[model samples]
Target: MTTRTLGRLRRTDFPYYAAHPDVVYLDSGATSQRPETVISAEADFVRADYAAVHRGSSVATGEATWAFEAARERVGAFVGAGERELVWTAGATDAINMIALGISDASQGLGSAELALSAGDEIVVTEAEHHANLIPWQRLAARTGAVLRHVAVDADGLWSLDEMRGAVSSRTRLIAFPHVSNVTGQIAPVTDVVGVAAEVGALTVLDACQSVPHMPVDVSALGVDFAAFSAHKMLGPTGIGALYGRAELLDVLPPARTGGSMITTVTMDEAEFLPAPNRFEAGTQPVSQAIGFGAAADYLASLGMSDVRSHEEGIAQALVETVTRTPGVRLIGPAPGAERAAIASVIVDGVHAHDVGQFLDDRGVTIRTGHHCAQPLHRALGVPATVRASASVYTDIDDVSRFGEALGEVRDYFGVTT
Candidate 1:
């Protein structure tokens, strides 16, 4: 790894990064700060190569199709999936919805007529799921008459492996869960969970929104049936993401949306959909954004996920130490020393999460403050929301220290000193 390829590790050169001498950003889990290369790549695509892909026979269409499919290959390489296994979607939310919709279609005589879900079948999730993962399964269960079941978490927001193991049974149809929790920073034992599900002949669905961007994720090696993630979280442009499913599984699953590019032949009463990726990616795709996403993936690959994970761990450890030293501050999620992400959620004595966010903002430190789309987890943890500070590859030690100092002053600002 050459230093030039890695670029300067300092907090500079970050696109949309305005360095106030005292300002710091820590809300990377919500959305990461993009680099200049990613921004320029998207701009260049729009400026030089904007055209409708997978349609028409013109030279421009060929170029556009090449760019779009090349992005599929780039993103596929990043996650250890094949080019044909990657399907473009609007975002992670859309990807999850697509999976739910595909399953619904499979059950409803749209495609794969042999596999139909009915009442008494179970769909498993966890108590710590984000609404994106939770609501889709809720609707799937309700619509298909399948019962929804979930593994419970303890007070620390940690769920035991045995708890999940016990939940799987012959009736379990699918298991949808996050590889890493957004609020708790808790890393789930996906392999173990998948093992139990496989024993019951159930499918494994992973919400890799947090894991794929930050770490080196090999979906094939992980043995997941399907996985979903967004581009913006990994320094790519928004409105673009990818879903990876086993080639065999996607070939049989029907796409949620139907349109021009997704079909091969259509008659008055019947239609034949395209193959795995094309079938799911209906209509004109996000070409420019996909191009930019490929660049982002390339950049991250150049940096290497091992280095990214190590650097992020350094920041997380320092931030957790600072939180523990601070008075009247309570750190939520997995305990320190647990395998987790660089995200840390905290609650201050006599201070609301929103108020703490405002206080941090006044100090020029940016952090996320909310339920983080994990309302059920918050409800289980006995709080409405929390203040979260997350890190990315662009983040430096100085940013972590600045945010820690700002956090130290929070209790004093609210006069909740212990």
Candidate 2:
């Protein structure tokens, strides 16, 4: 393999191992590679501070409890949310499920909220959502006898703002979409979308899985009823994620998964639930992961999200230019130089995405391939799948250049180039 070995990543201020001089990772959109600090933080918790959080009695437990809540405050500060509004879950999928399950419980008489769903009620989503955001809404509509409507996307996998505006009517009860489409890399105007939904008194849910990790996010400014994202994508451990909801709203929503920790009191026939966050957390929380995630959030903050965003944008721009000049390559999503994230999904003519990925791999370049969990967006763009190269804060110009060089050879290897 042609090696693009940079050197020891420790030579740089960025905590991640970017200078391996042997690897060029480009799949940050799916999950980012962790820094040494973030990785060690998780290990530190298990090796030393392994007590249960929020419900323990021992002195060690008390210290652990303080650490746990401190982690909550850190995450809250990073995302522009408050401790009262945040509920911990397993991941973005788990968080989304929590919201849907809570709403479903409300409709099914488990909650205090006046959630009355009929066949005429509608739940709106976009064609560009990951399955995590789409499937839950589909299940909610199925269970509530509500209709599901989707805002269509353009040929570039961009959803029309006008169509989304039209989709919201009196019948629309809830709307859900991603802050940034994972496949397309296009940043959605979240405030605009939420504003429209708010106008009609519809609840809004945002899948912030892509945005929270890459850019500075202020959930308060988004003005949505709920938002969810995973810790792993943001360089934390896999088992922890967060769901942010309005304190007043979560107060009325019922617990989805019930057990020991989530209850206030229990009787043989009836049980009273705890407050918003604890009521939803239910079982043994991901205490160690939360501690580690707090460290990750702190690390990102230290670097400043502004710096990280600018670095990845530079890589994306360079990758876009390289793709445009390469033969038989069609860039997916918005055109190059458009306001986008670090991801670039592209199709190589006469080659399956898997083959393109394999070709890149043989040359020591790592890029993500396939539908990227947004199959609807792929279909709308008229491709079965695409090879996606996503950069991260640690990614530099060399990695992007390697990806471009490898991609330029793909058409020739597949006999697509004249």
Ten contiguous residues minimizing lDDT sum, candidate 2: 1-10
The RMSD (Cα, Å) of candidate 1 is 2.1
Candidate 1 lDDT tens digits, 1-418: 2222222353465756654545677887988878778888889889988999989999998998898888889999999997689889999989889888888988887778634577889999999898999999999999999999999988877777898888878999899999988887888788888788889889889999899878879999889999999998998889998899989988988889998889999999988989889998888789999998999898888878887777777777877888888888888877777778888899888899999999889878899999999988888889898999987886766776778888888778777755
| Overall lDDT per candidate, in order of appearance | 0.85, 0.85
Clashing pairs in 2: 5-21, 5-22, 6-21, 7-19
TM-scores for all candidates? 0.96, 0.95
Q: Can you write out model 2's per-residue Cα lDDT over 1-418, one digit (the tens) per residue?
A: 0112211232254444455556788888888777778878889888998898777689888988888888989998999987689888999999999888878888887776555566779999999999999999899999988999999999888897899998889999899999988988889898899889878889899999999888889998888889999898987888899999988888887778999888888999999988877888888888888998999899889867886777667777878888888888888888877988988899888899999999999998989999998888888888889999987776777888889999999888877754
Best TM-score goes to which candidate?
1
Estimate the Cα RMSD of every predicted model relative to the unseen true structure. 2.1, 3.1
lDDT of residue 262 for candidate 1: 91
Instruction: Provide the lowest-lDDT 10-residue window in model 1.
Output: 1-10
